[model samples]
Target: MSFDPAQALRLAHDTLDIEAAAVLGLKRRLGDDFARAVALVLGITGRVVVMGMGKSGHVGRKIAATLASTGTPAFFVHPAEASHGDLGMIQPRDAVLAVSNSGEVDELTVLLPLVKRLGVPLLAMTGHPQSTLARHADVVLDSGVEKEACPLNLAPTASTTAQLALGDALAVALLDARGFRAEDFARSHPGGALGRRLLTRVSDIMRSGDAVPRVLPGADFSHLMREMTRKGLGASAIADADGRVLGIFTDGDLRRLVETGRDLRALTAREVMHAAPRTIAADALAAEAAEVMEKHRITVLLATGADGRLTGALNSNDLMRAKVI
Candidate 1:
């Protein structure tokens, strides 16, 4: 059959409309039963054991990940596998969350009695509140939808959308109840961009010790240039004997000086530096350093110790490499 472009576009729009309605319908039906599910999971000492079959299993896996990342301990256990041996993965302290639009999939229903025997609370996310799964559940969450988004009204389209939205709502409510913070989320996602921004400190990414370009006030222009060249910082800090930053001189300053057409041989670090250069606390967040650099329209920033002494130096490249910006 030839593809009709206009028909395909219309179907896409209709599918989205149907799915959106299914999710919105859940908001109206949400009440005491939803609250009970959240409270039951919160009171549990062990993880939430999620299980399902086929398409529902796919959504169950995603829900488990969302729950685990948002401060709730959870994992997905395939229902068919439970009969073989995976049932051991579920403990007495854990709560079982089963997802099924029909709520009577044999593989899942077969395990319900065993889950109950283990004294694990069963939370049902199903369209049929009176189905076997819901009948066995300690808390029944109504994931019912008017119809599937498929053209034949048979596929698990709108039903899955409703399940996913309901799962998200539960995770959000639980996270808020637990007071889960962004810093806590960063700990769970150390390799992600948000993690780098929240957990990386200026000192962690800045060049410190011998890598920091610096020269004393009495140093000649040649010495200052050599320090900048060796460190490749494109700039050098002019410091007192105790390593307290007194000034900063950059390549831009050198260019301006050369434009003057004056003799540069007599210049010392103190004679050519900009005094009281902008600095950030060594312990400041790398994200905060990025904010400062963006606000000042500068690439390099000096990191200072408590005594206002030079601790380290960082540039835009350093922050980019750290994935903190």
Candidate 2:
């Protein structure tokens, strides 16, 4: 038989449509139990334990990660492992979130007695409220979907999506309740690019001290160019005789002066320097410095201390190296 590409495409589209509808239906399913679950998690001083089996386990692991990154401290434990010896990971102060479509996963049922004995609060997400797992839980989040996207009705597709969405709902609710901030998220994800962008400070990545390029305002153009070359920052700060900043001169100025046929050797720094160039405070965040650079469409900016003395210089490349961009 010839393969029907058009029919396969139609089937794929149908599956996506059904799954999207299933997820949308869960919005109305949210109720007081969801609020209670959020309260239970927020009130705890310890971590949250998420447990599930098979497809549910995959969803559980992601939920645990999202919760931990947002504000709530949590992790996932395999249900079968809990039956063996992993139940020790669940502390009395912690709460347990269990995911099971039929609420009859053998491993979960075996671990139910241990969950109850430990006095840990249990939150259940299942299709059946009358199921044993639901009856055992302190709060039941009904993730019931009318049908699976799988045409054969055997594969766990839409049901798993519903469970994942419900878990996110729980995480977002807890995040708002805890007043979670971007810095808090960055702390949990320090190795990621976003973490570097948010957590890194200007002081952490800026070049200072001898690395800074600076020249007195009255210094000749030749001396300023020498400082810029020696420092390798493409620019040098024009400072007052007392070492307070005046402005900056860069390669762009050099190009303009060349076009005007001004002899660099004969010209003074004051003749070619930009007056009152935009500067950032040394204490300002590196991310903020990046924003300023982008807004001005300039590649180089001078950093100054509170006294308006040249502190350091930042180039666009520094931000890229720090992953602030």
**lDDT per model vs. reference:** 0.94, 0.88
Which pairs clash inside model 1? none
Q: lDDT by residue for model 2 over 1-325, one digit each (tens)?
A: 9999999999899889988988888887777888898888887888999999999999999999999899899999999888778899989999999999999989898888889999999999998888999999999999988889888988999999999889999999999898998888888889888788788877777889889898877788778888999999988888887667788898888888799876678877777889999998888888989999999999888888888877888999999998898
TM-score of each: 0.98, 0.96
lDDT of candidate 1 over 1-325, digit per residue (tens): 8999999999999999999999999999999999999999999999999998989999999999999999999999999999999999988899999999999999999998999999999999999999999999999999999999999989899999999999999999999999999999998999999899999999999999999999999999889988999999879999998989999999889899999987788889999999999999999999999999999988889999998889999999999999887
Q: Give the range of the ten consecutive residues with the poorest summed lDDT in model 1.
A: 260-269
- Relative to the unseen true structure, what is the C-alpha lDDT of residue 91 in candidate 2, on a scale of 0 to 100? 94
Q: What's the lDDT for candidate 1?
A: 0.94
Q: Whole-model lDDT for model 2 versus the true structure?
A: 0.88
Off by over 4 Å in 2: none
Residue 85 lDDT in model 1?
99
Single out the weakest 10-residue window by summed lDDT for candidate 2. Answer: 262-271
Once fitted onto the true fold, the runs of candidate 1 whose alpha carbons sit more than 4 angstroms away are none
